[model samples]
Target: MSRLNHQWISQLPIKKITNVKPVSGGDINEAYQITTPDKKYFMKVQPNKTAKYFGHEINGLKALGKAIRAPKPLYNGQINGDAYLVLNWIDAGYQGSQSELGQLVAKMHSQTNDKFGFVDNHETGALNKTNNWDDNWSRFYVEQRLEPEIEACEKLGRWNKWRQQHMDNMISAFRKYYQNHEVVPSLCHGDLWSGNYMFDTEGHPLLIDPDAVYGDREYDLAMTTIFGGFNDEFYQAYQQTFPFDDGLQDRLQWYRFFYLCLHLILFGETYGGSVDSILGGF
Candidate 1:
């Protein structure tokens, strides 16, 4: 709320400031669509009351900006000494009856990467995607992906201890069950949930506000499946395009545990049971 910042905001060439309303998006951040007479722009102002995590989000969005049907990142800047993101606003509609969810996601899965990992962005305050991008999914999953979370959980005194203390059992299941060969890097919208995806007025899908990265495609699909996004029609569509490996029942937790650990970190004990169940399965 500095005088200089207010003066600068007033300089934005807005035709008519129609409305600025709070749009409920996520628990951690603030979202709004600022409408003008001629056009609209999506606005995200992070809650200054908490430590900044949207830094990662901005980086993630930039990574996914190349997606065929996702929102384009317009500009990200600071106002009144806090962070905000302005993006291309779409006339997004929903389709609960549409079973094409899985099929469309499969199309998204077709989007690939150069190798694995992405070039870092400094202005957006993004972390470097530190992982071995080779074809080996398990080593990449355990060493580069899950290890960091497990260590952090231990540091935070969470119950990752059940698996961390007996790491061998988890590995045994992972090795014996899932048999994914070297998977090509499908640039993934790392956090794929119901909220991150939208359907435009035309029923064409658009994924927005991605926490994007490059990794095994299963990791992305696994999350959406767990959280109840698309229905069997979606899965059927995706299956027709590129069928998933059999025995998802055995290895689903192998991917899900990463997210479960994250929720445990972000939301605490409400997710503790899920973590326990995944670990207990092994």
Candidate 2:
């Protein structure tokens, strides 16, 4: 308790970390709820060594602020050179179920990107997604997005070798599919998942911990459905606001394959068979 208290209070640019407590999160970083004369603030000590994300995290928070959705990044500084992040804690209490979540996330994604990608660079799971962009979604997705992770997975021995041929074929198929597809770079939460979203008191989603990127809007939308967090209502609401092509349903998998491979890399065997299965199906 003393060590954590010192870490939170003493290291903070503020003083008197009264009512300091741990905040639950699935992040590898440590989070805390601290009460001060001002108000409650959420603080996280980021893993500075393995974390290239702090810089991007700063940008993502700013981006989310501009979009006017998601939590705002407050203050961050180093304590003994380890990075810490502060965020205005919004009660991300669940406001609705699947469908509502779908709608809000779609709105968030609707916020456009700067040119193609931003200057920030970071890794998505174990894979290093390119900050560089091109006008072509299929080319960008294949060469920059999927190709790196696939190669990394092979190097890490986390890859499902059986799926290489499948990926090759999918790549070819997507090349043709992309030919007919319109390319637009939308601001993506980079990693939008059910866990990443929370409903505020007004029932609107306030997204947090983005791996923000500028990519095909579908990439963000598709990731929502990858592990099954959103529902049809979300899709419906999103379409009403920002409609997709008539053929999106038939083409959803085209976007989903990236994260499946990503999960296969991040979680190891739990994701291995599924990766092969998806590749096989393709």
Candidate 3:
């Protein structure tokens, strides 16, 4: 681990820092467990980024915390060309209730917005997202989400005639189906994969590292299905709490295609087949 600059350390609100140990924070940032005599905190450092790099995350945590358990953001700033965010530490625990987690997520999805988007645009890896507000969900999704990703894939030489044909078909299908269906602009944890959630010391589920947006709730549910951490109990509770509209299962595949396609752009051909599988279905 690179030694944190003394100047940077001094700028932090905490004092008498005793130890700083590395921790798993995922692929994007350098994570550390900060220790003092009386307290511990989780910090994420993004090299060469401005303080604004963590602005979206702070907004997300505040939004999610209102409806579900989420880490409390303490502070964020830039020093020595690295941007960092500090959050209240959550001790890891085993055996959190999946049903409770499901209920919490369902409650969170109930928070709606007047339009689809967020206060600011966000980024995943090097790719930037345009989250401009729009009244029409289909037009917003197709223009802001799908088109940008496809453009990135094309620039990377990952596009082809076959993919293009399927993509056009999928877009048409998505627009046509949603034209009749009324979709509420519900808040979503844009990245809801298994690794983004954890059980605290009290066995309570806590959401972390959100890429939040106000969009179709099914878009969030689609992320749950792509990974296997959530079980039958979780889905059962979610359905009981907030019953889904008919044909939700079918629409989930379309949202799944968006995430898989993003993975393909971020990680290359390993995810190409998964993206194609969804597109082929369309």
Candidate 4:
């Protein structure tokens, strides 16, 4: 924690700052457990240049509303060169049954919008994801989600001739699999891997660190499978609430490939083979 953070916490409209201790599980921001005489809060701080990231979070949580249990945004501001967001501190809780979590997530995904994207952009790990308004899901995903990461991989010397060919082929397959059809612009948690959510003390799920967007709700379900841990019950419950499209199971790898691209850019060759494996399916 920086001294500037301490100063900023002291100046908040609360009782005097009592204690500030470091917390873990955040990918991009420095997190801390802040205590005041009146209450406790979680503070997530990143560079001032990434202030928009925190702002997106505040807006995303507001959009989530009461549909899901998540950290309530209490404050968003800057301290020195860093931007910080304060949220209500939730007590650590044990993981709940997959079925319960799945049904709950389905209820949250029921929220929809007239179009795809968000009011603003969001980040996945360190990379920014554009949520520019587009009514067409395929065009929005291909242009905003896939292309930027592909370009990044090329610039980073990670895209070879064979890889480029495979990516192009995959995109072609994507177009064939998806057309401007009946896909709804459902609210998505955006990044819902195993590690991104937790349960509260009573074993109810509480989402954290959302990169929320409005897109094919299947995009969110697809991510649940990518990182593992979610059991068949979760999928079964989600399906019970909302059934899958005809080819969603077959097209799962393509959407998972997007996250693999993000990992390849963030962590390098360790994730390279995974991307290759997904492309091989096309």
Per-model TM-score on C-alpha atoms: 0.81, 0.89, 0.97, 0.93
lDDT of 1 by residue, 182-261 (tens): 56778777778777788887777767766666777888887886788667677778789878877655556677888887
Off by over 4 Å in 3: none
Q: lDDT tens digits, residues 81-174, model 3?
A: 8898999999999889999889988998999999999998897564789889999999999999999999999999888999999999999999
Best by lDDT: 3
True-structure Cα RMSD, model 3: 1.2
Q: Quote the positional error of residue 200 for candidate 2 in Å.
A: 1.9
Q: What is the C-alpha lDDT of each candidate?
A: 0.66, 0.73, 0.90, 0.82
Of models 1 and 2, which has the larger TM-score?
Answer: 2
lDDT of 4 at 109: 90
Off by over 4 Å in 2: 1-8, 48-52, 97-100
For model 4, where is the 10-residue window of minimal lDDT? 1-10
How many residue pairs collide in each prediction? 2, 2, 0, 0
TM-score of candidate 4 to 2 decimals: 0.93
RMSD of each: 4.0, 2.4, 1.2, 1.9
